[model samples]
Target: MPSHAPDRFDEVPGDLSRVGAHRAPRPRHHRVRAFAWAAL
Candidate 1:
């Protein structure tokens, strides 16, 4: 799962675009979630 985090960080921007205009919230949420996990 640790390996997956950086992968997701790399993907998030591309995903934000593909996910459309509503992408803002989701990315922010995931970023926060990712940071929280990383902090642990």
Candidate 2:
């Protein structure tokens, strides 16, 4: 029996285009914490 599967490469471009338009928001304190964690 043959199975049908959707192509992932076709779906990825549309998903990335949609998300690329939006800018992510981050709090100042959160940014500071993230940097501190990375330094450790």
Clashes of each: 0, 0
Candidate 2: tens digits of C-alpha lDDT, residues 1-35: 99778785434454333454353445569888999
- Clashing pairs in model 2, backbone N/Cα/C closer than 3 A: none
Which candidate has the top score in TM-score?
Answer: 1
Q: Looking at model 2, report the run of 10 residues with the lowest lDDT sum.
A: 14-23
TM-score against truth, every candidate: 0.32, 0.31
RMSD of each: 13.0, 7.2
* Cα lDDT, model 2, residue 6: 72
Off by over 4 Å in 1: 1-16, 19-28
Tens-place lDDT digits, model 1, residues 1-40:
3554365444556534456346555445788899899999
TM-score of candidate 1 against the unseen true structure: 0.32
Displacement of residue 15 (Cα, Å) in model 2 is: 22
Q: How high is the CA lDDT of each candidate model?
A: 0.61, 0.61
**Model 2: CA > 4 A from native:** 1-28
